[model samples]
Target: MDFATWDDRVEKFRIPAIQYRALVESLQAENTIFNDDAKAFYQVDLVASLEMEPYQHQSEALAAWKLAGRQGVVVLPTAAGKTYLAQMAMQATPRTTLIVVPTLDLMHQWYAHLKAAFPDADVGLLGGGSRDKSSILVATYDSAAIHAETIGSMYALIIFDECHHLPTDFNRVIAEYAIAPYRLGLSATPERTDGKHADLNILIGKEVYRKRAEDLAGKALAEHEIVQIKVKLSQHERERYNKLMQIRNDFLRESKISLGSIQGWQHFVMASARSQAGRKAMLAHREAKEIALGTDGKIRILTDLLAEHYPDRILIFTADNNTVYKISNEFLIPAITHQTPVKERHEILTKFKEGEFKSLVASHVLNEGVDVPAARIAIILSGTGSVREYTQRLGRVLRKGQEANKQAILYEVVTEDTSEEGTSARRRNEPQRTQRTQSKEGEKKGDLKVVYGTGQKKTPRAAEQLGLWNDSGDTPNF
Candidate 1:
């Protein structure tokens, strides 16, 4: 095809440049050879060997990936050895590999793991202000996307860590530009609210293996419990919340905007940008959210819980950086946010791990891909409604420890009689339902109850007596 014709076809079909390999392979199978340029340049020898025996589930996942022609996504819970599985894949494939991660922290984590796994080989870094290339490379998504077209052809295999981030408009280009015939995508939660995860089938491959938190809870992960603590807003905070909510509700009603759908939210955002009334409504909405997320009553309950769980490593999560800073200042705890310097963040985490710091506070920075296996307690002061976010936070504390009877606890602090209640309920319900279903399946198979939050069920009355629930009921209104 001529250049103009090829460009037209590519634009019309939305065809990715990476698919050129498949086309060439099909033609070669038909006994057609266009040129010597179609030959593969990445015949790599395996220099890294497996350091340890693979877990049963990890072996099963590897077998499945090999069955699928060495290309697919594997869904494993965080701290369930996903990185090790990727290392195994690299050993089996033995090709020039590029690993893409979501954040700078994860980029460094992967680089360290790759270095340790392949000690004899040179591993390169391509993010956090460093740009070096080697047979095995670890890069942040932003860096990979920026240089994808230039260096995409150097790798024969591409592994996408936190592969859910790959489906974005920009990040997807990295997969499109690479001619790698072998690919693997890894994620604990691959489902996206924008429905972009479907593109994984084209970008990487279909999900060849899957496991949930309940699927490997007792054996691979720690036994855990999720405690929902409902704290009421003070009278003054309640009045302020009600007034701000009233203004927001009135504006929504007048504008006939329903936030039940994504389109409705987009419309509300655009409307808010274009008019004065809309701006006031937006401000009111923000204030109401702030009130619900960071109430004095919640802080009081947090104080009680901190005292109760003293000396156990705790990780506190919040919805915004403001709340993170507030909790950090109030509790005199080290805080890690996006604004935190890399050196400071590392020091904070190191101290927390060594038990020098009993607790750490963060907004959304630690929600994914950061390893904190020593954390046994997690307190959610405020968070988003996304199930992925909730699951990641829970996984942070569920990593198994040396003690066989170790029980990880996640305390979810929600403002009662506010919109956060519904958000919390919706996010919690789906995961619980899925866990229950998986737990029953495991029982039918005569396997151990591989489920978190099922070891000792806490009743509502017990929770209330323990000050985790209000006296009104399990879920108290007002």
Candidate 2:
């Protein structure tokens, strides 16, 4: 009988580590005597008892994960207790576990939670300047990938937080080399724009449990409303936007490039780097996007909405750091960007949570896995076409809080008659296309309101004359 043999050159088995599962299954089917020594070091007694009872969906998710031989991804919306669900999985499996997180903040957060969950257990940290190893360990993806070959066999169960990030080239190596018999992946938005999320089926496992934001609305999450506010660019801004768009359009036509797919965008980027005209076109595109995203009219509308929701905890989201800082300065609000120090970031969040700060503005730092349950109002001043960003920002406010009757409000400020109109529509349309039918009922689209400038009111007819609002009265489906 033939079995896996050691390979001296690679310092690994002749067969790839990823095939261990199939090999073991095949050997078992043939009634072969298989001595499993790879996981011998991982034998440990783990007792993880939850302080709070598992929610209904959590129990169902746990059941499904266990039913799948303890291997698969669990799709739960942000604030739907994905962390707790991971804890439940840990408690159920009760084996040497390795939890991989995407960010250092998340690594620390998981480390804290695990320590609290199992006070007596030996937990370790493997990222952010720490390299301790124990029966239960938490590590950042970059650190885990760097040490995958060495530490892959130390855990019997591996859980990936924000599992969508696991399909990347470098990160996939962690899962490929790890011989963990049981795997679990958790994510709110698992589908990547590049379509690489399909690889999770092989890298981790097929999705075993799933729930959308709307599915738990009013039950496990706060009821939410999506409001769209349309604002027309000023005369000068409008002219500039048109001119820049014309240049971009000319380049697209001459280059025969369609910016529909990821590959097309990459081609445009490469072409822009090589030719002067392409570079000019790319510059024009960026100018147009900036003009559309940060128009004076949108700022005025934002001011008004902030005034209206001043009493509620609001989160302001933007596409870039420039906009975040701009808004922060204009409103004198605390801002968090990639450049913000970790200590400062945490301090700002603490103050905001304590009501010392009513609003906090951010670019992309708070998009995922950051807990801010007190925030009930989220204003999207500007963002990308990514649905994940849209949903994540919305989820920041959907976390259940003491204000059980409080409604979560997401205000999407758009520049009317610009490319932003299409971008906003596409982001809102994503959930309708992918989410479960039950979740769709929670999304209620409000009437589109047009604002001229700060503290200025215009009649509906005046807005219509400016071509800000359409006559059909059909709002963009949220």
Q: Cα deviation of 323 in candidate 2 (Å)? A: 1.6
Residue 142, candidate 2: alpha-carbon lDDT? 97
How do the predictions measure up, each by TM-score? 0.84, 0.87
lDDT per residue (tens digit) for residues 316-350 in model 2: 99999998988999999999988999789889999
Identify the runs in model 2 with alpha carbons over 4 angstroms from their true place: 1-13, 41-43, 430-447, 450-478
lDDT of 2: 0.80
Clash pairs detected, candidate 2: none
Best by lDDT: 2
